[model samples]
Target: MDNISARENRQARLKRMLAPTSAVFIGGASMIPAVDNCRARGFQGPIYVVNPRRSELAGIPCVPNIASLPEVPEVAFIAVPRENVVGVVGELSAIGVAGAICNSAGFSEMRGGEQAQRDLVAAAGEMPVIGPNCPGVANFADRSVFMMDFFGEHDQNGSVALISNGGSYLSDLGSSDRSLPVAYSVGLGNQAMITAADVLDVVLDDERIRAVNIYFESIRNSAALSAAALKAARKGIPVIAIKGGRTTAGQRATQSHTASLAGDDTVASALFKRLGFVQVSTHTEALETLKMLVHAPKVKGRRTAYATSSGTYAVLGSDIAEANGLDLQPPSAEAAAEIEKHLPPFVHAANPLDIVSSADDGKKTLDIYRAFLSGNLDVAVNVMCYPPEGGWDPTTWDTNTTMFAQAARERGLPAAFVNTMPEMISRSVRERMIAEGLVPLQGLEDGLRAVSNAIRSSELAEIVARKSDEEILLPLYSANVTNPIALDEASAKAELANVGISVPRSVVVKPDQATSFEDLTFPVVVKALSADLSHKSELGAVALSLGTSDEAWRAVCSMAENLKKTAPEIAVSDFLVEEMVKDGVGELLVGIRRVDGIGLALTIGIGGTQAELLRDTATILLPASRDTIAEALRSLKLYQMLDGWRGRRKGDVEAAVDTIQKFSQFAISNGERFVEAEINPVIVRPQGKGVVAVDAVMRLAR
Candidate 1:
């Protein structure tokens, strides 16, 4: 059957699933809420007790078995012995249960039987399973259906819903109303089957769910989750996810806890940012960020404006904004004129609107605030921190001094209140700030990161989707690919050259005919053209810049001999004697590597060892556009060098980007036939000018 049919069948099965007599079932010996948290918070959903020996629990009748239930259970919590899990699931599936909280242990995570656990989890036929070993699920706004409690007697704030893999950390993350109102809180123990992707689809499409906070551990299904997250992102629903396990030990712990396959944390970080998700590290920070997104409106663009009561807070705010890719627009001439008349001489007009030394000056703050209320700024940050030390504490600042925030809320501009005195702030004051549409963050960095990430989550999705439009029709070279000798660099370049790319002048040299320097030219490059010597440079199969005729002949003979050392028995072929290409404006490194879940990722970086050491690299998805290629280059850490650092001439940035963009098109065009290739030094020239490939390699996919 097709996807729609499969999905329709799953829905039908879900509808027939039984409803639990106890809406919230506790399978473990977890501590229950002593206070009337459920009734106080308007949770009228029935609470069910499923202990076999007990008759009643939490003032409700208890059922001995699944068949003894008053009605079919819509959801059930499983925490029986490991050996009995399969039998319990078998019965639950047979009875047509819709969803479940699998708290039982020993499926795959702690041990090594991944396949067995996967099969068992699939018994319910794609039914959503939270964990085989987990802390269970909670619907906070649906009336305290959780064994654990974050707050007492807290009403539905209608702000953000949170999902985490690690329950220990989230339980400690201050879930007070002082942050944002949390709609739901769920912890997936092992993430047995139904993943973050499926759950996110519900939140993204739900009108009541404003923003989502995902505390991720191991990502088993990245592509599915990414697609689901983008759905939420497109609807302006900010998703802040923290992929735990940055170190070896951390990764191991993560694997044990959630059976997650943790690879490189940097890769995970990069993936989160690229896929329009805000990546965080700690629970304290993720909580604050979620609150900010819930409190702040959707950002229109990157530009930001600042209006603050203190001078030092402005600097801290600007530093944070710039570091996180948020543009703090400089005050316009008109805004500057107004600043000049009322502001302190020391505080010059700039990106940060520092109404200098506002010791007793509320007007300076108000004037700057009102000016920015209609200025070129898309967002604003009004800092309430001490001099030189940025903290988040409302009690430290004058509580009455909230006019800057007032104007921002009135204008519907996304804004954050930056406070440095986190410890000094009272819970009541913090709640007041959140109620007034201001997110209370620990310091400058966290505050700006929260805002920038939320904006990037929405904007990056649109940006990446644009990449799907420009498709390609060419391929790259690789060594592992089949029939390498039949299609060498010269041949591959010749092929790509047909699809709009430039290749340098070259000629193939047979073993019988060796060319002297005087005959071939003063400077020439000798490249072994045999599949037997794939990694040419590694096997001394490549020689560049021959000064004399004798040296050129010797180099070729040596390369021919080394072919045996490179690939023992493979047949050898003629080499290439090409004129050495001259120095150009820039050396662009372009290569192709398959990215898991994202398909092919065309890489463009600074050539030579810096590409590895400095890691001054950027990536573009396959069939990327000229605009995306150019933007990707600009996004690198060492991109300033391409823009002419200090006084040096700017490398041919445009030409280099164009070449890579074309190569990406080529990679996609060739599809399965082409495996991979890399052009280390592509010479680039002036504006909109063409580029030349100095060296290239390709391997046809076997």
Candidate 2:
């Protein structure tokens, strides 16, 4: 498949196969909600409900089967028994339905039915399906509702959109029953048929849908979703995602709730962070992120002014803002001075504009708020929790809050109203806040988190979309034959060294070989050279700091003997002897992964096995520039060590990052053909000295 042919094929698929589909065929007796939902949503398209026996439903005509459909249904939803689903999908495909939603049970999530699940997968080639056990879908922009709950009167804000696998969970937030701007949503149960990426592919064209809510149980085509997410971010449209599971219990709930195969959630978190999503946990919070997506004004650059009523809120917000890698700073002097006229003596006119909640005068409230929103301030924060009013007219608190809010809206700046009671904030208040284009957050923490995430996603998207240079994508090559696989340390380094990465000097000796010929001196580390020994050190397959040659020989002999005892199948190539890296300030773990929902993600964290347990890691999009790299590293909890902790000399942070950055680019370049690559303990020596990779592991995509 050449590029031209592929492009032509895709173009044909778009024109001949996919169009703004109207009237989807609903298949299943259990899909009563989907059928009822379609009618309530005022679906302009025709309905062809498919069931074994049903004459009429929701006042729409029903068909006995797919063959009776009046015309080639644009979309077909198969919600029959698992055994019958594949066959029904075949009929829908034969009749020319472009897309299908499979709500059948007994797929991958089914217990002890691996063969049945595999058979179900085989039937997916006929048409795209959402789930084998999904509740259904909803498209607010097109007025198509396939889920039971989203039919309630929703806000037509037109800026933000949501997609979720747990439709009812999110709909509970919609139960605020307040009008909102919703584009579409879907509860993709198993995603065995129609995928999240496929839905994005269909809806990305909706200009009315400025943002997207990507709800998922598992990420299948992460590359496609990443591209779409990046696209949305570049366009200043936000994607708020509520991945179904992150805990063992959550993963189990995902399996039982909607019948999905949930994997490691850390991967999902990193992916969402990279691919431009405001990741939330519950369905309610998922919608909360829409505040930032729809209300906040897009910045021309990364510059931002952070304002808060409380100094503490401002400080925490600033910390969070910077941590997620934002430029939250005090408002400019001119901006502060403008607000000073209204500030009380107790409330200093600071960047945070801490207008001490003690003030009761309406004029003071309006004056300070107006100054912050006077276009001079880029964004402002208001800590609203009904501050102690001394029992003044309870309505007085309401009046003051409303007046202050109105002033901010009157101006062009984006302001966030943070309530201390996160879950307690009324839905009506939230809807009112959104109507005025105000970002309302549950607490000070939530507010800062949402804004910071949006800013990072927006900035990274801009950077990636505009990128078109060599630096944007680095080159990598292995010195040894890559097909057979490069196992030796020297071979791995030769390949990495080409791209400017550093590797420890080493001498390789064959298994059972003597230390006499080993060129590397004493106090060296010995590692068994076998692909199977990926985590060599973990299984005592590696020895470090062998001060004596006898110890080095014994370690090598021990590793070889161990491998033979464990599994004679693993062919031992050679034993690696290299100086044990000890001069580095601290160990750093660098890795590149193609995330399930997002594309190329580069992760940097504290080294050793506890890395995953601590989750003390930072994630960023691949091909990041040096400036962004520095910013991301600076946000780490280990940044103090990197910055010369406890009088120890600072490591060559720039050089170490350069190597990690290069590795990330390499992984991205090989993304089409590789699954993931990791290099642990990229030891960074003192300043002026470079870093070296002690070991690495690369997993090829099967």
Candidate 3:
């Protein structure tokens, strides 16, 4: 099928699954909760229960079988035994059902369920299936709830969608007391036929969704996910995600620095950033971030204004704000003058303004807030903690919060009601804040971090907006290597030099060849030339800084002797003699490698022997522009030294960037022909001189 047609078909199936007109439950009593949940969510359509043994389920008469149903269901929830899931799905598919949620477990996740999973997929055919081991979906917007598990009462009017690979996590997030505005919740389960990308593509089409939060253990389809994320960016919807299982357990074992540094998690991080998704570390941050995005307008900048009645909160807020990259500048001179009029004589006007207890009056608090927000800030935050009911009268707290919200609204600024502790804010106050058009952020640290993430989302949106579809989409290639070839240093350098990257003048000669050194420069370096010698220095196969022809020849002989003792099984027949790079400013490691699920990734970082020890690297997914390459370079800490540190001469940064860009283009053009390529310690000379690839390695798969 064509791309558009396939997408349309997938989307159509998803629409039916998420908002089915008529549904059938294919099981006995275990499917009762799904039926009841669907009905409780106000599903007015007919719901059929299919079980040959039971005549009734959850007050509904059972139809006995799929053949006995009154009408063809738009969707089905199959909770039969694992062995019968395939047959049921095939029957539904034959009947032209839109989709099915295979609630049956023991597929793909179990030790001996691989073939069953494959059989399930084959049975599904073109019909979309959510999971064989997943909790079904819950769509609050259309009031279609087909979930197997009970996730507390939720309002139909919500703006965020939660999707997860783990069923329990989805249930927990849906039932959490954080009061997140949830529009849809889906547990992906095994993702038999339907993937997270497929779900996201359909979810993004919902106009009611303002933000999406996902918890994924792995990304099954990167290209589709990238396209969906680009659509989200264009539509100005933020995607917050928490990726599980971040270990490098099954990464390819290669001798290249790229493989060591650019692990699966690192590449995934780069992919998320490139796709303009906000990746959070914990569920709290994800929930808090979703609240920020759903409740307020996007923060335009980092300039923030913090206001609190307690001095301690003011100090804590200031510290948290700074730590999270929020720019909490002091109030302007005119605004300070205006704020001082409301504060007592002892209080000073500043950012994180402490309006002491003396200014307890509602009118004075509102005046102070108005004055504080007048300082040209992008966001306004108020730190307020309400005591438990009956412990203290909340009349003053309510009045102050109302005034604070009013002041921020009058100024046309996004505002947040931040509490020091998560439990300090009651449900009533949180709902009130939401009604007042303000975000009620629970924890101080998580709230500030969420604010930072929200602001970063805005920035990333702008960046993604400037990129074309071609640039935004990653070129994911299949990894089918039958014949693999690892190129020696000379051949690798030739490949790099062919692409306009600078390489030193070099000559490859046999160890037994009688060669004249007059053609080469006086000061030269010698190294054993063999594809098997990945770490030449560690293998005692490298010799450097020879000042003359005899010295170079002697170094080559010594290298042969050392290699014989180090690796006697290998025969080093040839050696590489090259001129030493002089007056170099620094070294850099530029590498490109294809990750299994992800596409080709370009990693640039501090090079030389300590590259892994420093670990100061930044990655960019390929099909990236030169501007993106430069940005990645600039993010590295070594960029400071390359750009001239402590009055030192600047390295040829432009040359380095150009080299990396060309290298990336070469990888893209070659596609699956090559698996990995790296240039360690690409000596970057002083500004205007150029960069030279001194040491290199490359592996090709045919």
Per-model TM-score versus the true fold = 0.75, 0.73, 0.95
TM-score for candidate 2, residues paired by index: 0.73
Candidate 1 lDDT over residue span 341-387, tens digit each: 66677767666765546525565555656665667777877766543
lDDT of 1: 0.62
Top candidate (lDDT): 3
TM-score-sorted candidate list, best first: 3, 1, 2
lDDT (Cα, 0-100) at 514 in candidate 1: 51
Clashing pairs in 3: none
Cα shift from native, residue 292, model 3 (Å): 1.1
Would you list the C-alpha lDDT of every candidate in the order shown?
Answer: 0.62, 0.62, 0.86
Which portions of model 2 show Cα errors greater than 4 Å? Answer: 1-29, 51-54, 58-62, 112-126, 148-151, 155-157, 247-266, 299-365, 371-376, 385-398, 409-411, 419-458, 469-515, 518-680, 683-702
**C-alpha lDDT of residue 631 in model 1:** 77
Model 1, poorest ten-residue lDDT window?
Answer: 253-262
Highest TM-score against the true fold, candidate: 3
Is 1 or 3 the stronger prediction by lDDT?
3
Candidate 1 stretches greater than 4 Å from native: 8-64, 144-154, 172-177, 246-275, 279-285, 301-318, 325-377, 385-399, 407-415, 435-437, 454-524, 527-541, 547-553, 559-585, 633-676, 683-702
